[model samples]
Target chain A: MKNLIKNFFAVEEVSAHCDGPCGVYDPADARIKAEAVLSMTKKILAMAAPDPSDAAAVVAYNNTMSRYIAIKEDQAHGTKTDILVLWTDFFKPQHLEATPDLHDKIWKATKLCSACKTTVSLESAEALMAAVEDIHNIFWAAKGRDVAYYTAS
Target chain B: MQKYPENAGFFEYVLLLLGRRKRIRVTGASMLPGLKDGDELFVDPYAYVATHPEEGDIVLAWHPREADLKIIKRVSMVLDNGCWLVGDNPAESTDSSQYGIFAFKRIVGKVTSRS
Candidate 1:
């Protein structure tokens, strides 16, 4: 029977699947998320301090600032996740031969992510963006692809 | 079109000695874009009996991590100690990168043709 024949030859071929951890990775993922964090920080800083005399104005300002902080927090974490995935999955041990400081760079970049989420400073957010750009350049270079630098306007 | 062994062992050797290749059904995606899961191929065990596997050849070898496990991977590089076996789809494969080099004796056969 066809079923019997199929079962007879069904040899389990063990595949690495790259362990299902590696695939095409793009640094643009971290860039966009870091951008969100920066944009949120800027918006929060630009919001006028609510009128102290008006309870509603104070509440409105508080609500808006909290929302911006929440977005920044989420996106900052997302940036960290994107960077870590590319670092762990895409980059191989051989990549370190090309970019000798890649490990230190990733370490500092991830730490920047935490700083952005913990603080409302635009400076830290911009620093996170810079770190992500560094990673992006390294990633593209490893792939022999040319990509333009990401900037915040 | 003859009945093959349920467990590929002595019967495969018997068939090879008879000048016929053994058929094996691929069950993984490590060789993606070339070989797929469920694709059938004729393995020429005698192909390397008098020789050695060259780079870029797809080979069936015992998993270095486990003795009973068998894996299908490409010979990326032949090192002084052993061969560096890697899967075409590294993202899902656990090859030389994870388990180190594969010993020459572990290689079972060479995948000659696919159907």
Candidate 2:
């Protein structure tokens, strides 16, 4: 019978849904970028001021310090983007029920990203890393997956 | 009477589809210009068994997050672990840009032809 054949095949219906590909969230990207921010901040803070009397030394130091600042800012911005994507695209309303402070947490994390970019503060860099780690844990918890967070740095 | 031609791809689809025929009713605008909503399509489940999915190939795959939901998208890039897919109708489709990457194993089959 057609019914029997149809039941045997049982071709279920599929759909093309929206709201981004599912379960693509990973906090590791933010962590890696934040680590770079932290490393660059450290290097910048440790660099000795070039001799004020020697123009060449000053220029070289300025060149190196500028490069570090550029990298630090770039990485911080990248970290912010990654975190914001997770906040906006990954987290849902139900997650708020579990972590009511989710909004505040993401807001502060993004703020820290900006702070890291504006200043070469080791304190801010470390804070960003901590914040990112916290987000990592929260993200994994929401997915009910125990993904261990690690830093390449 | 002799028939000149029909949809050219249907012949290929028939040959490759074999016993893995699956009928899918498209309902999204993701694949616009070429495929429209309510179009009937047949899938070749064995299309990628021996070979891998290549760029420009349209495929039906499991939604990475929602396992029960199967989605159709075109492969844009082939990565080490998976493929990057996007909807043909970029304005309407939420794809790799929305998610990130889809594991290769999630692919169900190639969208062979219109039925």
Candidate 3:
């Protein structure tokens, strides 16, 4: 009965796959944005605390700090999005076979980006950069290239 | 060699009554809830041959840049040239948002039913 039904139905198989085309993926995008996150983190950490009684200094300090924090959060988010796009779209199962820890690395990198957004931690920001550089090496290695990792800062 | 590819035998019977239907295996988490991974779907290749696909239709289309890659996404907007396709699960989907809109000609079939 199964053979008869299979022959009668004649179902040709198709696949409902997801992939982002254009063949233009680069880890540099994530690197640059993540670098901004690190830069902003450093600026925020290095900024001198204003005297509470000096109203003008307090106001100016607050404004500058807020701006730095905003930029850090925004850039961290952009970096996260870029990393995720590369993780899901650019890297495939074949790449996973080569780099078995790819998923763990991406997971930690994105987590660090989130940490950068939530806190003003220099360590987290630096870790994010290191993670992105690791991914950069993996990405270029997949393409059979030896691209050097550089920072805008 | 077989007359038809992908398990379609030489002695075909269903094609005459059903137009053209192919079994599509869902391969990603994009169409979750409605369609899960490994779900088999029947796609009608001739559904949009005569008329353009309307918005809200689930379609099996070729990846705009990669001719051989097939993607299943819902028609979000019907544009002048093509359609903006989005997956049901936004977090997991890399659709029109990432690669831009897909042209009408790239669409291969419309999903009819799940098996």
Q: Best candidate per DockQ, number?
A: 1
Give the TM-scores of the predictions, in the order they appear: 0.58, 0.56, 0.55
Q: Write model 2 residue lDDT over A64-107, tens digit each, in one string.
A: 99999999999999999999989876776679998999999999
- Score residue A36 of candidate 2 by CA lDDT: 97
Q: Is the docking of candidate 2 incorrect, acceptable, medium or high quality?
A: incorrect
What lDDT tens digits, residue by residue, belong to model 1 across residues B1-115? 2112133445454544465565667775566656777776667767677777888888888876566777788888987767898877665577888889888888888876652
DockQ of 1: 0.22
For each of the candidates, give the backbone clash count: 14, 0, 0
Q: In model 3, what lDDT does residue B7 have? A: 33
Query: Which of candidates 2 and 3 reaches a greater TM-score?
Result: 2
Better of 1 and 3 by DockQ: 1
After superposition on all C-alphas, the RMSD of every candidate to the true structure, in Å, is: 12.0, 12.6, 9.8
lDDT of 3 by residue, B1-115 (tens): 1111123343332642455666667786677557667766667789888999988788888876775678888888999999999887665677899878889988888876654
| All candidates: TM-score of chain A | 0.83, 0.88, 0.85
iRMS, all models: 5.6, 6.5, 6.0
* Candidate 3 ranges with C-alpha deviation above 4 Å: A1-21, B1-115
Find the 10 residues in a row with the least total lDDT in model 3 chain A. A13-22
lDDT of 2 by residue, B1-115 (tens): 2111124254544453356666677876667657767766667788888888988888898887775888888899999999999887665677888788988888888876655
**Predicted candidate 3 versus true structure: per-residue lDDT over A1-153, tens digit per residue:** 434544456554444445544347899999999999999999999999999999999999999999999999999999999999998867866788889999999999999999999999999999999999999999999989999888877
| TM-score pick, better of 1 and 2 | 1
